[model samples]
Target: MQRQPIAEAVREDIVNGKELVFVDFDHTLLACNSSELFIAACKPSWLVACIDLVVRRLIPWKLTHVPHWYRLRDYACCALIVLLCPWNVMLWKRGAPDLFRRHESRELAVSLRACDPTRLVIVSFGLQWIIRALLSESSWRDTPLVATPNLAGPAYFSSGKLDIVRAHYPDEVIARAACISDSLDDQDILHAVGKGVLIEPQGDVYRAEEHLYLPLRYTAAAKYARSYVLDQFLFVDVLIVIAATSFGFSTLWQACLFVPPLMLSLMCVYELGYFENDMVAARKEVAPTLTAKVERYRTYPIGFGAWAWALVLGLLGVLLGWHFGALRSETLLVSAACWLAVLAVVRAVFFAYNGTATRWRAFFYPVLQLLKYGSPFVLILASLPGAVLVLSQIMLMWCSYLIYRAGGNNKAFNRDVLRLMMFGLGGVCLAASFRSAPVEGFFPYAITAAWACARVFKAPIMRACKTLRSRPARRSETAL
Candidate 1:
């Protein structure tokens, strides 16, 4: 016998007084996109995947928002999906179950449990096969699914969803239905429905109970103050200060007295810069859709309280600096003047860095890094060897950041290479330290080398131990 149509079946269920509820799958029910998860699960080369992500996912996604570009974007997305279908099919079958369990939106999942099974329907612009594979053993497995069927044509999206749903149900049925989605693209269907539930990000998880209306305004209160404070705790800057003081001053007691207040003032100023940078980023946001606007609002929520706290902290830093003889002409005046000048220049560079175009940001980043690493030099009257040691450390840090950003297919290989580089830098510092003063040069180099080794090896050693512990459990499971 032939199977009944999906819309006909769904309409039959809705006829029994249960209002139809159409829920989006990706980003609404799950914390991430299903297609991206599938790509990751395929275990392709990292570089290839990164490139694919930018070209296929990011570019097409951005293009979809441009006027009159929807068709082109859809065609491009569909073509890329078709090209990757074979690989996706081969991998998703094995990985879907695990991916579903790991990435399901817990808050949404809880809310969904209270939803009437008969009234609920899973609708997605993602591949039907992939979604089906993911939900094979899930609670929603038997629920009606309205998804893009095959590589037949462009995926149903925006108003297309409304048209597809209308094919299944009459105008009256649609008039009384509800749509739960994260994207503003679903606004057409949402307006047609009786109720609209919007999914929103709350810290680490997603919540979807908020009633969605067009022209969504910024409403979330400042919740990221603690996060901002934590971000400003620049321990590396403190280390640089300590290294400079130890080498420049006659006694270690001077470092003890000077480092704290100096660091406080520096961190406070840096945090103000961070706030400015955040504001700049917020201003540059292109949020055409209500959903995009809401997300962007949440990301850069108005937080004058944070600004106030930063100012207070900065005042406290200044007070502490004054109390610690930071204002004293003999101990801190010349150094402070020099440090202030450097700080002024760096802060100006930071402003320029924020204002510069995206392509030019890379050029400014290294200069900012140098300011961060080399500013401590003003605290000390440094010899050539001591300066070389500091410069060497700065280069090491800059190179490490670049390596991390330029991720490759083999992460382990990249990590090993970074470790070797760290060791080599440490050895160079150790040799240079022998030629300089004992207290200033030797001690700073020793501390720098030790810190580098500790930081580099800590994560890998922890991972190795974790793997070793897990091996026994895996072996036992295999035997069973």
Candidate 2:
């Protein structure tokens, strides 16, 4: 007794008057390497530095498992902080240079699509222009698209998303659909009619009555909704339980007993920051499929070193307590006043820089980009002794990730001030983590110094790349 083949089953289902709605995009309709397109689009910018990071940091492809319905909810639950931050990927497009499109334009434009024998519907919540442009340019124009119509106004991604799908495709007999989407927003599609395909490359062997799937595919709309996909409500239940248990057992003082929480926070921030940055670059399409590898993990033995030093100050408090000194001793009072003044001045200057300048434009702009971006560590530094730094880091990581994601298909970033920003932040965090007072004082000044050094080094790297690109391509002798 041998088993029947899968394709035969699919053909059988289709031939029996089952209206096959090949109702997903990305990996389903258009077949191209999205990750390859993403990286190619983002090339040649200083963001290439992040590429530099990924090249160095890429975990073996073996370990990067594709999260399906079950795992996505687990990941999303842990990413609660990342999700709460505001994202504005829309801005990256405005700032992008036109040259970005030159190298990274679509491969199989709409003209190349084969006619869909089955009814193909592209369900989406992204801007109509974006989907339209991609479709118009691709051979997929003949395929019907059932997305939230924004020919009207700004519709919430969540509000009418399900309604649009429901109104169009009602039952399995009316439409036998094969959903090739990674996000659970299409769980309606999964539950309603037929098979749900995961575009991601790795996952468990999933089974259902009519459903089948592949790995996750990176579509603009699907990527946005990926977390909400599947039986996620149950996963949420598990997370709430974890939160309750962590809260019940872990007091503020006991929080310092181990490194898992802080290390995890740092890992989350590190990944989310680069994730957003890549998304910003790849906003024209989906976010780039790459990671920024940082070696700062090696150097960062003492995160919140400033706070640790403050604890030593508390030891001074203990000595004073033993001697029965007043809480406001003259010497101690003066040190506290000076510390307060330094904090106010630093914060004011940071705000000013963020409001006005880039990291390098007339010196002040570089400072501004630094302060605006690096203000997380500033607040973290200011709110020492408590766990406010962890929360601040969480907020910045999530916010930065969103801003990075909102950019359009283009991945070009203006390199001047933000160039100053990368090292500026790294410098601040490095500084804050140093325990010595002199080292801490020296850290703030390093942002300016690092900006100058980066500007100088950037030129040589460009010259080398130009020389390489200028070399002529070698053609095969068979052509001659």
Candidate 3:
């Protein structure tokens, strides 16, 4: 029998009032079978392999000769053996290069995301724990899955899939639903549905028929460039760099000469830091919460090598800028070294206290943000001819204004406003003081004064805002 295309099968089912779509897990929705990956993660043992071999051999004989509903003893035995292994050992092995590879079919994941979650079901003979773990971060996290349980019952393959379907839906509903699978063993469930879609091993769509044949169209999202430019925050970094250059009163020529190399160097440096952080977290037996998508699997040694490459690229960019006379090479080197030293100290502190209290972490959060978002521009200004010294103060004022606008709570907003007001006054003082003293002499004074004002009035300003907001609410309640 010639198989129809997947799109045609799906349309027929939907037209027939079938809302539910049952998809097989292994080669159907995922790039590879997760069970195989799990087995491969374990240390090779001929004894274990032979045991699994016996189990596989017995599965068919027992299922065919015994009652269809009879418990799959061999399958249960295999699952117990696999799941009982030490989780730590398995995780360590999983980190090995190319040892256990499992990637989902992005095309299928996107296609299913378009459908209602409640209308999707995953039925497979693979281990349920492995399947669930893999889907934890995916769009299908909450979708219903009926696979071979860790320990129990008949295997969820062939006739077993139909059995599970009947348990979940009415006979009429099952008749209207569509089941998608690649294995010929899925024939029983496929025939039970209104329409069926058979996917080839290479992810091509095919008609649900006896033999797999022919190629179809391929679809995949742009992964590499998108991951860096958008997902890794490089786009926002470029915008910030350009905006700062404009604000610093730099000419268009200067901006054109410096922006690309500056952006490239910063992007590489920041990504290197993130890669190193992730590897450190992984080694500490903690999965990193904040990691770049591209550096998800990077190990510490790999990250170190990448960081070295980034340093080289950044140095090359600096050399080119110096050759163009856009910056003083000696000043740039000194300033960058100072900034890098500061960053290294912060990172060392962070790693030393990897599991510090939330309050302590929160205290350092603003400082970290300033380092990550503001340091590059400051270092660049040190080498280039810009009012960088003065503009740094103005940048603080602008950032405070932005914070005021975005502060969710009224008290926070008022506090931010007060900080901005202090910044404005400090800027005025600096402009006046610059005439009497050198910029170097007055710059420290302005920063010191601004810091003193914020420290002194921070609590009082926040308290006043809170009191003001409460008065109106209290008055409304009194009137009621």
Candidate 4:
């Protein structure tokens, strides 16, 4: 039976000659899926445990063969509803008001309220009872809704929804109507309507605009580029190159002249490795776990532009090095050949690492890190002290990686372990200085010790001072 206000509104809309507007309920009017929320609210302990087991244990094995686990999960939830219809209905009725208030998209709700109530209709694949119960206490109580009739029946989704709309209104009405939805599944209905408005998810908010249905690759190019370039910063590599040059050359002018081009070349190599690794991961279907940022990264398409840019930067670095006397005529050919060989080896290792499955990928990570950190040594082959410094730094980093992995990969724990390792390396370098050139050895010790102490103790000292300050405030409050 049609409510009086909805019937009256429809009659008035027809009289006023306004076209009907259709909006999807889930992820459009609401910020979350209503069916998932219903299942979460009403599922018993046994059902919850079963679902958890399937997700954690069974799903992983099936992921390689069946990527559509979400559809299966939805079917399971619908099956539960059919199995325990009476209990679910009771639970939903009791919880509907609170759930609706918490999950309704306030911005969309406001926009929807501004529309002529008679011309606006809510359409969804969600069960009718659930939708009605959620909207019972809202201002939209009388809004006409076309939804799945029951859990056991076929969902009024996709073409079925179009058929139902056609039955309810004349052909002329649908031809002039507009649809708002977040799903591509509603493309048929969107085409049937005169206009389509898409609700695109951007971080925490949804942006609604005219639907152009752009391809994922084109829409997400900027996001993918940002992820590739900014995800892991290259400052540590910069510092390594600077430290190497300072230890290698006695004259400050020589160090200054050579470091810039060497650093540029190293950066180009790192960027090339990153680009190839990401491309291989994409082809092998080894995507990162689902998150908003990672999802954007996954959409990055293979392109020649990034490859061309990396090659250009590398060539520029080589030219600058030759012009600046870093690659003198006497040794230019040998040095360039060695550098090319090193580049080839690094690229091969990256391909191997990227092609490996996730289960065994960790084993390759340390090797990859070692090659990257050690590659700068090829440019500073003449300095024994610089070579020693670089070797010690690599050892410290490698030990830290081992400790980090052994400790279940907790980031805070890894940081503390790295600091302790740095302190030890500093002490070793300081003692070794007595046997070698004091200035060369002392430089590394000074850098490592100062950095380690500052990072490791800064947090504790600040916390102690904060506690002391808070005690005085608490004492004053007690006296009052």
| 42-158 per-residue lDDT for model 3 (tens digits) | 433323444454554345655465444223534553465565555524563335223213366665565666666788899877667667766766667788998776654443433
What ranges in model 4 sit over 4 Å off?
1-235, 248-291, 299-306, 323-337, 357-363, 381-389, 403-407, 414-480
Better of 3 and 4 by lDDT: 4
TM-score of each candidate?
0.39, 0.27, 0.36, 0.43
Model 1 misplaced regions, further than 4 Å: 1-235, 247-261, 271-344, 380-390, 400-441, 464-480
**186-230: candidate 2 lDDT, tens digit per residue:** 555555556554443112221110011111111111233444332
Q: Model 4: how far is 107 from its true place, Å? A: 24
Specify the highest-lDDT model's number.
Answer: 4
| Tens-digit lDDT track of model 1 for 7-118 | 3223323334468888888877766776555544443333334344455546746545634354344334434544755565666677787778887777767666666788
Order the numbered candidates by TM-score, best leading. Answer: 4, 1, 3, 2
Worst 10 residues of 2 by lDDT: 208-217
Q: Which regions in candidate 3 have their CA more than 4 angstroms from the true location? A: 5-18, 44-77, 88-102, 155-158, 202-480
**Cα RMSDs of all predictions?**
19.5, 21.5, 20.3, 19.8
What are the per-residue Cα lDDT tens digits for candidate 4 across 214-312?
122222332245343332223344444444445333432454555555544444454445545554564665344222443334333223323333344
Q: Model 3: what TM-score?
A: 0.36
